[model samples]
Target: MGKKFFVAGTDTEIGKTTIACGLLEKANQLRLRTLALKPVAAGAERTAEGARNDDALALMQSASIELSYEQVNPVLFAPPIAPHIAAQQAGKRLTVSQLAGYCRGTLMTPSDFALVEGAGGWRVPLSGRETLAGLAVELQLPVILVIGMKLGCLNHALLTAEAIRRDGLPLVGWVANRVDPDMSCFDENVETLKQFLPAPCLGVVPHLPGASPAALAEHLDISPLGY
Candidate 1:
């Protein structure tokens, strides 16, 4: 069986997709087949193909094993809002079982790697009673956290790591994405995380003018991830 990983983030807009695609690029470098799944997505735009998400599109480009947009992002919400709120506005119901089942089937595909990304954060709501984290637990996939390095990153990263551990999910590794290029003492903050978080720092990505998966791939070191 191939390896499956859950790409989670400390908070929204924290370079989760950037890190996920970089991992896909690394798998491609090893000539391994990869499938990237964004099971549920919000903030979609109408396109020639239909409503699509930029993050899902980027992931599709990075994936080695091609699949339709629908296959990659099964549930899409038009409003640029929280998933549960969007679902409620659209009169659609989401459940942990549904997403878990989709992930299970995707894992059965013949691929060297499968990376699934969550919408916002680990505990974002999929429904009134169920959270996206519940689906990750159901899938039992080890997590790769994307930490957006900035002023409050130390607290955010540590808290996110603690929550993942409390949920009994293995924090396989983490990526340090420099969102704020001007943030002072950047290297020191990274060193502090290394001292605290148990997982290895897979990579420390710096700010780029126009970053693509292939471009960011050069900055990432996936050796510690064992993929």
Candidate 2:
């Protein structure tokens, strides 16, 4: 068994899936067996058999371990809304324990590493009072904060790190994802983060279309994130 990490973003649309895949790709390149778990994914597309999220699909692509879709994405909702609301519409109850059980069963087996990706932001509701932060706390895995480089991102990143710290989870490192091409002072923002954030900037992903994980890994300079 190896270190399991919870990959969280400052906000939705902040490239959590991209960063998770990049980690898997990089670890696999080192010839380590890896698996990815999405835990809970809302806004799924319906297929002939069932529904799936693109993030889930990408995780499946990156995972060296073959897991059933249910193992990778346990709680899935058809609509793209808050997990609580989506679950309500479908008459399903969402809870951290349900997700935790799935992860336990799936990841209990030995492997080089496991990366569990959370949906939405850290404080997004999983159920009534169970936020993603609570789940991360329960799992007790080191966290990889994915900072989407954009206007107002500094506040988002700091606030999220504070929340994670308050939750008492380990802040392993972070990735600077350039989601905004026109984000002014991007390098300056990175410099500030390097100074303030206790964790290293694992990577700074430049804005590019069709950027492979191999290319992303080249720019990544963070010390190996975990044991």
Candidate 3:
């Protein structure tokens, strides 16, 4: 079995996919086979193949082990909205068990590294009672948090880390992605996170526009992830 991690973010548009792909690229640099899965994604466009999401596509491109689009992202919603709402709009039900089943095959594939990226944040809803966190819990995978560095990141990162621990999952590592270029005291904020979050700091990615996973990979250190 590969080293698999459930990647979560502080919030939406917080570079979760960016950090995940970067990690995959880093693994590839070390000649390590890699796989990535985005089991549930909202916001997709119709494609020749089927409903496709940009984030999932990026992950597919980054992984050394190839998988079909459906394999990488089994659940896709057309509207760019919360997944639970999108499921309701399409008359479909989103459940943690169903999503976990979608991911099991790829997770079991032979590889040195694998990642299962979640939609939105850790507490994203799948149904009235089930949150996306339950899927990670079901898999019993350790977590890698992506913090979008900016104002209020301290609170967001701490609360997210707390929730992951509260769910009885280990927070293996975290990445600090500089989403806010102009945020004051950025170094101090990162220092605060290192002080508070109960995990090793994997990387600190500066804000780079239109950067590819290969470029972002230079900013990350996958050593702490046991690569």
Measured by TM-score, the strongest candidate is 3
Per-residue error for 51 in candidate 1, Å, reads 1.1
lDDT of every model, 2 decimals: 0.90, 0.86, 0.93
In the range 163-198, model 1's lDDT, one tens digit per residue, is: 999999999999999999899999999999999999
Candidate 1: RMSD to truth: 1.0
User: Compared with the true structure, what per-residue lDDT tens digits does model 2 show for residues 1-227?
Assistant: 77788999999988899888888888887777899999888888888768898899889998788988888998888888888888888888887877788888888967887899999998999778788777787788889999999999999999999999988987889999999999999999999998988887788899865677677767665345753
For candidate 3, the C-alpha RMSD (Å) to the true structure equals 0.7
True-structure lDDT of candidate 1: 0.90
Q: Estimate, for each residue in 98-200, the C-alpha lDDT of model 3 and write its tens digit.
A: 8889899778789889999999999999988999999999999999999999888899999999999999999999999999999999999999899998899
**Candidate 3 global CA lDDT score:** 0.93
Instruction: Give the top-scoring candidate (lDDT).
Output: 3
What is the Cα-based lDDT of residue 165 in candidate 2? 91
TM-scores of the models, in the given order? Answer: 0.97, 0.96, 0.98
User: Can you list the residue pairs that collide in candidate 3?
Assistant: none
How displaced is residue 122 in candidate 3, in Å?
A: 0.7
